[model samples]
Target: MMTDLHVVPARRGRAVRLAKGQAIQIINTHGQQVVDTWCFNADDMSEFMSMEHLHATLQGIFPATGDGLTTNRRRPILILEEDTSPGRHDTVIAACDVHRYAALGCTQYHDNCTDNLRAALGHLDLRTADCPAPLNLWMNIPVSPDGKITWGEPLSKPGDHVTLRAALDCIVVMSTCPQDMIPINGAACTPTEVHYRLIA
Candidate 1:
């Protein structure tokens, strides 16, 4: 049986935290919102997250149940407990920075993903000097047969969400993407919410 969950809407430039063992549900409240996420060991910031290893363990392009999110040292960070919407997430697209903004014709939004990372790091009393690559969740990015990835349409609707349980003491930093130059976070930037609930 699925449990009834509460929903939260996190606007652009906002940050939220999810404790170990608790579940964090990221919802695209306004449809087609891209949430860039970075996970690190709260106790040790040097130990960062690695997406290449994570994808290898999953044995698929996207994450699903029985898949383990591993760290740089190949340690299991989080297990994919549930994926309400699969085949819609992109682990390859790194977080947008100032350079990307300038290249993408949106230099005005120079402080996109970097700012969000700083906010989340500040909340955890961690330093942002070493911002790691992020995991783009709920964003529709498809790789063509020619081995090229192009930004696709929004995969999530107004209420679509993805849930995951923490496998360790992890510090999750997410940015409800405010990218307006592309259609990843919808044509217009919107808010998203992070809901937490402990499993008994």
Candidate 2:
């Protein structure tokens, strides 16, 4: 069974519950918006997806279709079941926060992925003391041989999506990253909404 498409409003976040074996198809509705994604065990929030452990598990950074998304405990929580884009989802960048915006010269508070995750979880009456580094869906950060990283615009076209299948009962949280000072989302430096739906 497939549910109706849902929107993760621009510059905001959304969370969903996924039973074991269920999947979520997240759409890059406008083509270039980066969605910061996180997953936590429904039974134990502390056992959330860990990018560091994932790097060791996969022996690489970018997780493509068929790759197991591992948790802090080094077990599969979700698998990248499908990807319609160029398979450039980033795993190295930390979710943007007020400090990040401030470094970019923001004088006032700005919408951020860190806060977005917190608020999203709050709606579900859940909390996590740590904001684990997210799996940055569609974020294009090119790495050079010298280990330098250059923020590149997304290469995905409108409507491209990735299907992530859960291997454990968990909560999936997504945040349409609100970074506008740089062009990670797109060359336009504009953030936009993305869509998602649950699938059996």
Assess each prediction's global lDDT (C-alpha) against the native.
0.67, 0.96
Clashing pairs in 2: none
Regions more than 4 Å wrong, model 2: none
Q: Model 2, 120: alpha-carbon shift in Å? A: 0.3
- Candidate 1 overall lDDT versus native: 0.67
Evaluated with TM-score, which candidate comes out highest? 2
Residue 187 alpha-carbon offset, candidate 1, angstroms: 4.1
- Where is model 1 poorest over a 10-residue stretch in terms of lDDT? 191-200
Model 1 agreement with the true structure over 79-163: per-residue lDDT tens digits: 6676666547778877877778888776464557777788767765677566666778787888889989888767666666666
Question: What lDDT, from 0 to 1, does candidate 2 have?
Answer: 0.96
